[model samples]
Target: MAERKLLAGHAIRRLRRQLGLSQVAMAEALDMSPSYLNLIERNQRPVSAAVLLRLAEAYDFDPRKLNAAAPGGGADAVRRRLSDPLFADLAIDRHQLEEWLAGAPDGAEAFARAYDRMGGGAAPGAAPDAEAAVRREIERWRNHFPDLDAVAEALADELRMGAGDLYGAMAERLRVKHQLSVRILPAEVMPGLTRRLDLHARQLQLSEMLDPSSRSFALAEQLAQEARGEIDALVRGAALDRLGERMYRRHLTGYFAAALTMPYARFLRACEASGYDVALLERRFGASWEQIAHRLTTLHRVGARGLPFFLLRVDRAGQVSKRLAGASAAPLAEGAGTCPLWNVYEAFARPDELLTQLVALEDGSRWFTMTRCVRRHGMRVGGVAARFAVTLGLTTGAAGPLAAAAGVALEGAAVPIGLGCRACTRPDCPQRSAAPTGRTRVMPERETGASPFGFAAD
Candidate 1:
């Protein structure tokens, strides 16, 4: 630790300000001259181990966190962001990034954020917005927050309800402990809102339109308000913008609600016993297939992990609505429109049934997928059922738990699929909607080919 320089100028400044102590006050407390502290805070001088210890002692922080920072993860992430094709035009080097991070942390962050969303939208690399960043984070973490999982599990123990009665238990807990009564109001009375907390009235009002599962979910979200300490800790660690923070917080709240309903320990047991049967699990837990698919992705607790599943939701227009990734793999779709070959889109045709497919990507990875159409929990869209198709997929071999139910599916031929039409290069795909970039379209005057467009490479 003493051998290497620890340039924590921005962190030190933040810590000092967080403590509400001025530079001179902090320097005096740390037994250092104000000028020297200023130099350290400005990154003109490296903070030594002794100074780090003194700062920790004076500010009640862990010195080891600073010592362990190494090159600072921010610089590394910025370098990776620069490497993306979106930033190919920007010629930012490592040294420049380090200096920017050290000298003007706030300005550097704003610049990086601006650079990330250069042209806006999810067209190729233009999507560095809070939603996309949170999506990437969900994929990176495999949609599982262990600390939140533990908290949900402890709460589940407190609720201690049987399979179908978790809702009543939660409501009762809210009523008895929090002095909050749960009231189901008509849609006309609640208007478009599904759930609202009236603190003055001590009531948690719910629209009568919400399904039982969604009502339980709403209560769980309210219950999650009390888990803000852990949630804030996790959110702060992410370092998101205002919108990004709110998005992540909402996602985490939903996660807590799901975990509270299923509870990791029991959910895993039910999953194993049922061999990943979505319907059986839905019946057992009184959750929708959508909710069951979501819970399946979160069984990544250490020493008791379930199969790492990938999940995605797509509407009839082939627009992606929800995306969840496996512990070992990235999620399926990057943008709204995805490959037409996947059964997630096909499931919409048979809305009530579970559809399974074995698909092989261009990369030679075969995934066994189970897809089903699901209605949105509590709301109608365009005066119709807000329906979406959800899919759960994992590597072919790892899907052994689903062998019996998905046996015929596993035995089926692997349909070729790609990331999406915009990013895919499968020239021979009959379902190809648009020409892949860098491919010259070839035409035959006298004959029509299997695909709408043929590439010169073909």
Candidate 2:
């Protein structure tokens, strides 16, 4: 159906965007021209079987995704439909369609086509690209010590307070100092009101309709921008980049704001007494699911006493947000830890479900993940109306009592996890969607099998 094709096209386009590739850039990589790439994107040119294989080989894209979603029909019918003589009435040619099919990559052409179908997409509002800013800041910080990451595991156990407490303290400071009004506006009001901070009016409005947890996080994020300068300054040095300087300031201020609400000593005590129950911690700090997740990862600063934990956040469709850790067994710095089998994706379609998994990394680390929905209560609004879930996971060695508190029964021993499929070296994994890098086919038909990739003698 047209609808199914559109959905598939949209997914392909999304992948292209996430990888930060432009149509021209992708065409160049795939050894094709940009104009022909454009036609394929419009779905006017069906992706050739060969290009699909190449995409899987290069990027680890699930090859099944391209062929499985389209309606059942041969490539020839698709070509005829595109080249229908009705187009000779329009002077369009079949050779143009064939050329696009033969030369372009799957995602490049699809992205162009989707754009044309959408009638030209527009940039979202300018509320600041927080993710980019955060990465820049974090990377700058990492560059400074080149060694701050060295003591994560040991320091995680030294910092006695749950990371949540520090974040909480920062949130409180914002509320009292700014007198920023925090309200739960209805879904319709979410657009203009969710993150409106009118400094002149001395008012901060948030959509109340958001789950109580998300409401608190939005407030905390705003407050953090102002409150934690002193804390962040303590770590200041010649290492911070311009953007990192700005974001670190915001992060520290947020920490101060959270500290204002939930002081370190006090929050630390609560975690000890409550046994680090995240749900209980959620109630204790008035924070959202993700806020609590972030707090868990930050438990490594000075004097904290807890096992090292690494945290990763992935959305429904597999876009990753935060990757933080004070742990050795984590690979948070390079790429998102994604597994197609991860139950986190289910949380989007089934909002009420809480899925847990013990994932293995290719390097042999085991991660304990908890996935649930974290939605901004809205259908149509200026702010994003899309509700997504977040998965908070740490290694099994550092999981502590929280797993028991949540009643999560551990599964079989951890499975191997990779930073991302491309950089992974796990051979013979059934879940692999693409060929591992450096793979080359020695035997042609012998390589034919359910698995898209064939064996290559390393």
Candidate 3:
């Protein structure tokens, strides 16, 4: 197959405009003729490899930005929006859609945003919910923030701390730099609260019910709030118009907490050396299973990177609370709990024990998954504790190295799984809760198969 030429004219124009550079100036920087640059910017000519290298060397531009799949890169998202059931009757062609995405990128993005706001309704100009919009933005970015990683790494170096001394260093910094005392309070005084900061008294309060690791994380979260300026700048640079200011700040703070707990370079090195061992890393860093799994999803730095793992947190009731995918992992669809056959659900049966599985999806793709159940500390001794199953998985093709290092065999028969019952097309799934949509159910007379619901043969 011939290699496709990169044609990201709109991206080029946007970058130039952002840098306050005219076409002539950009062309000069790239050592290209102004007319040729104009043609490239108009999508009439492809951005050649030489010019791509020149842009990188001269302007310090990210080469990925000139690729069609860069963040906010193309109209694929808009096309997916238009293909929804609401626009089924409207005749639209791929070429015309591409033209719109290329020539009028902003308008196409606006249309996509409006469609999202409609929330699958045919209604016009429906207001988008702020929380939902922020959630979508977080999903879009795959819950990874490189800027937060950089800031956290700098902070960790400045404090002269590693994974072991992170909590002590942060607490000392809080006391010396910010004059805030860390206090462990009883659950009665602070009901249903894990951590609370008293700005007036300059004290950070933590619940006594929390374990040592949880208390340390709470302190790191408080320190993250102090670095809100850096996080705010990152959110602003993201240019997510739908994300409300408050939601943006909250998510960024969460990012900071995760980053501070697992500084990028040190964590990445440890992950590689340990073959992505969750328990070992948790013990080493004084972090929890959920925290280690969540940190695995954020190893997206340019040069250094860990396995492209996807993390999923599901409650005992099977509701997915968080899902984050690394750069190379396949995305988990939103609004549906994964198939019950996956080890993620089974993890609840064996709490705190690492369960490994090879899952084969409906699309014929396979993945290696490891899951463990995590318990959240309650405010009181007899209080109900919240339990969640956390799963980390990678594509089977890329799982060889980590699986070998972690002493997991990849040659086992894989468990058949699906996105969800509603979306899955697997026939005769014993654990299937509901029949897949668009499939006709068949009922035999006095002769039922082992499976609950039978579907008509194709």
Write down the RMSD of candidate 2 (Cα, Å).
19.4
Encode model 3's per-residue lDDT on 407-456: one tens digit a residue: 66666678888777766767778787776655678878998776777876
Total clashes, candidate 2? Answer: 37
What lDDT would candidate 3 get against the real structure? 0.72
Model 2 / residue 255 / CA error / Å: 3.2
The predicted structure with the larger lDDT, 2 or 3, is 3
Model 2 agreement with the true structure over 1-458: per-residue lDDT tens digits: 22233223333455578799998887776667887666666565556656666667767887544433232112332332332212223434457544444444353345433332332222444333444434333332321111222222222223324354533433444556666554445656655445676776666666555565555555545644442343454346323446546666655544443443444445557776776666787787777666666555544333554445555666666776555533323453334246676666778778776677777765455677777887755335455656666766666755656644255544456656665554454566677666544445443754555455554645
Q: What is the Å distance of residue 139 in model 1 from its true position?
A: 2.8
TM-score of 2: 0.55
Q: Lowest summed-lDDT stretch of 10 residues in model 2? A: 143-152
The models' CA-based lDDT, in order, is: 0.74, 0.51, 0.72
Better of 2 and 3 by TM-score: 3
Assess candidate 1 and give its TM-score to the true structure.
0.73
Which is the better candidate, 1 or 3, if ranked by TM-score? Answer: 3
What's each prediction's TM-score? 0.73, 0.55, 0.80
